[model samples]
Target: MKPYLMIALCCGLYAGLVAAVEPITVAWRDKAPYHYRENGIEQGFLLRRAKHIFALAEVPAVFVERPSKRIWRDFERGKSSYCSIGWYRLAERERIAQFSVPFHVDPPHMLLVSPGARATVQAHKGVATLLQDGRISVGVVDGVSYGPALDRLIAGSANQVERVTVAPASLMQMVAANRMDYMFADEADWEYLRRHEEGLDAIVEQRFADMPAGLERYIVCSKDVPAQVMTRINRAIGALSDAAPGD
Candidate 1:
C-alpha cells in the first residue's frame, strides 16, 4: 500500500473505533407531568432532566416507553441503566439503587376526597376511624409502588380500611361514583388528572394545606451501575438545581 493510503486507513479505523460505542438507553412511562409523550416526543420535567443528565455526561441516550411497574422491575432486575425520578430515599431502596442528588423537593402530597367525605374522615382521627365510621372506601392505583409510608398504612390498617385498586385514570371514576371515598397521590399527578380528564375538576376536593412535606424526587439507577456514572449524574443534577422550577 502507498504510505499516504496507509495513514488514511489508520485514521479512518481510529474514527470508527470512537464511533462504535453504544448510547445508553433510558426508560420512561406515560404518566403525565413526569414522563410522557407529547407530539411524538418524550417530554416532561423529569424527562427533560434525564436528557440533560445524559448531555452532561456526554453520553448519547435513547428514551423508550415501559409501564411504570415494568420499569421499576427492570431496574430491580438490573435489566436497564435508567429509572425515573425517585420521590424519596427509603432505607430499603437505598440498598438496591444508587440515587443522584435530589433535584426537586415536591410539595406536600395532596389528599383528594369525594365531596362531603373530608370532614367526616378527618374527624375520626385515623384511616380505620374514617373507614369504619364513615364507611369510606380508600383507593390506591393498581400496580403503583407504595413507599414505606403507605406500606405501613396498609399493614396496620388493611382490615379496617376498604382498599380498592383502580387504574390511575379510573381512580377518579371510582371516587366520583362514591365507590371510593378518597384518592391520594402526588399533587402533580392530581393536577395532571384535572387537566386531562374533564368533569374531574368538580368531583374531587383537594386538601393541600394540611399535608406533610413531600418526598424529594431524584434520578436513580441500580446500585450495581458504575460509581462514575452515578457521580456524573449527581454532579449534573447539582449543576441543574438553579434551573429547576419552583415548587
Candidate 2:
C-alpha cells in the first residue's frame, strides 16, 4: 500500500473504534429549571448544557430519568460508563465518583416558609438564629446536601427536622401544607414552582443574610468511567462559554 493510503486506512480504523464505544448513561432527577420532564419530553437548562457538552466532545450519551437516590447508588456500585448531571462537588461524593469541571452555579438557597410559620421565620434576622430555634421545624430531603455551610448548621442545630425522600416540588407542597415550618430551596426552583405550581402562594419565600454563596454544580460519573472519556467531557465543559439559548 502507498504511504498516504496506509495513513488514511489507520485513521479510518481509529475513527471506527471511537464510534464503537458504548454510550454513557446520563442520569437526572426531577428538578425544574435544572433537569425535569415536561409533557413527556426532557427539558431544563442543565439538561440542554449536558447535551451540548457531550455533542462537543463527540461522545455518545443517553440521558435517563432516575431517582436521585438511585443515581448515587449506581455511582457507589462503580457502574461503568454512568454519569449524572448537576451534582454538587463534595468530599464524600468525590470518594464515590469523578467530577468534571464545574459547569453550573446556583444562587444561594432561601427558606420556603409555611404560612403558619411565616411570623416565626421572619422574626429571625439570620438563618443560624432560625435554625437554632427549637420551636421551629425544618423539612429536608434525605441524602441531599444544602451546600456544606447549611449542612453543618443543620447538623449542629437543636431544631426538629423532618427528612423525606421526595422531589423538591412535592417538598414545597409539604411546606404549603404546614407539615414543616420551612425548607431550604434554590431561588431558581422557587421561581419555577411559583409559576407552575398552584398553592405555592401559601409558602412564603424568604432569604437569609447568613446564607452561603452559591455552590457550583458539576457532572459526576461513576469511578469506573474511563479517564479519557472524563477528559473529553471536561474539555467540552471548559470550551463552552454560554450554554443557554434565547427563547
Candidate 3:
C-alpha cells in the first residue's frame, strides 16, 4: 500500500480518469423557504441550489442539520469541515469563514409587529427612529445579523430591544403573543412564517426607512475548506445561472 496505489484505487472506484474530490460537509439551520427539513428531507431554495451546484461540479457534499448557534460556532472554528448554504457576507462572518459566490439575493430587512403595535411603529420613520425614541421593545434573534444600520442602532441602544434566543419562527410567535413588540425579518423569511404561524394576521410589515438592503448571500464555507472546492462550487453556480434563461 503505497502513494500511487491509493490514487490508482480511488480513480478506479470513481471510474475513467476522474479524481476523487474531498467531501465538503455543507450544514445549515432550519430557515424555511431557504433551508429546512420537510418530512426528514433537506429542502429549500438555497439547499436545492447548493445540491445542484455540488452535483454539477462533481463535488461530494455531506449535509448536516443544526440550530443557528451551532452553525455559527462550527462555521467559525474552521477545523470541522462544515459549510453553510446561505449566509450573508457580514464583516464579522467574513473574518472567520470563506464565502462562495452568491446563490440567493433577498430583499431588505423589514420590521414585523403585531397589528396592535402598528400604530406605535408607524409613528416612527424606521427602526433607527424607534431606537432613538427609546419607546418600543423590538425583538431580535440572538445569533442572526440584521444588516448594518439596525445592528449599529440596536447595539448602541441595547435596552430598546428584546433578544430572543430562539428560532426565527418563535420570534414571530412572541410578537403575536405581545411578548415582543416587534422583530426584524427579511421579506422571504417573514412571508414563509406569516402563512404558517398562529395568530399571524396580527403581524405587520414595516419597510425600512433607515437603510438600504445589502449584498446577496454567499455559500459560507469554513476557511479550512480547500480553495479549489469553492472555485468549483462557484463555477457550478455560474453554470446554473447561465442555463436558466434558455430552459
Per-prediction TM-score to the true structure, in the order listed: 0.77, 0.87, 0.83
- Kindly list the per-residue Cα lDDT of model 1 for residues 99-180, writing each as its tens digit: 7788777776556676756665566554434434435556777545455565565555533354555566687766666666
What value does the lDDT take at residue 45 in candidate 1?
77
Ranking by lDDT: 2, 3, 1
81-168, model 2: which lDDT tens digit per residue? 8999998888999998999999888888988999999999999999988888999999998888998988999999878989999878
After superposition, candidate 1 runs with Cα above 4 Å error: 1-21, 80-83, 86-88, 116-119, 122-134, 158-165, 206-210, 244-247
lDDT of 3 by residue, 157-246 (tens): 644678768888887888888886777787888788777777777777778656556548878888777788789889988998888732
lDDT of each: 0.66, 0.89, 0.77
On TM-score, the leading prediction is: 2
The alpha-carbon lDDT assigned to residue 28 of candidate 3 equals 80
Residue 77 displacement in candidate 1 (angstroms): 2.8
Instruction: In candidate 1, list every pair of residues with a backbone clash.
Output: none
Candidate 3 CA-lDDT value: 0.77
**Pick by lDDT: which candidate is best?**
2
lDDT for 19 (candidate 3): 36
What count of clashes does model 3 give? 0
Backbone clash numbers for all candidates listed? 0, 0, 0
Q: On a 0 to 1 TM-score scale, where does candidate 2 land against the true structure?
A: 0.87
In model 2, where do residues sit more than 4 Å from their true spots?
1-20, 242-247
Pairs with backbone N, CA or C atoms under 3 Å apart (clashes), candidate 3: none
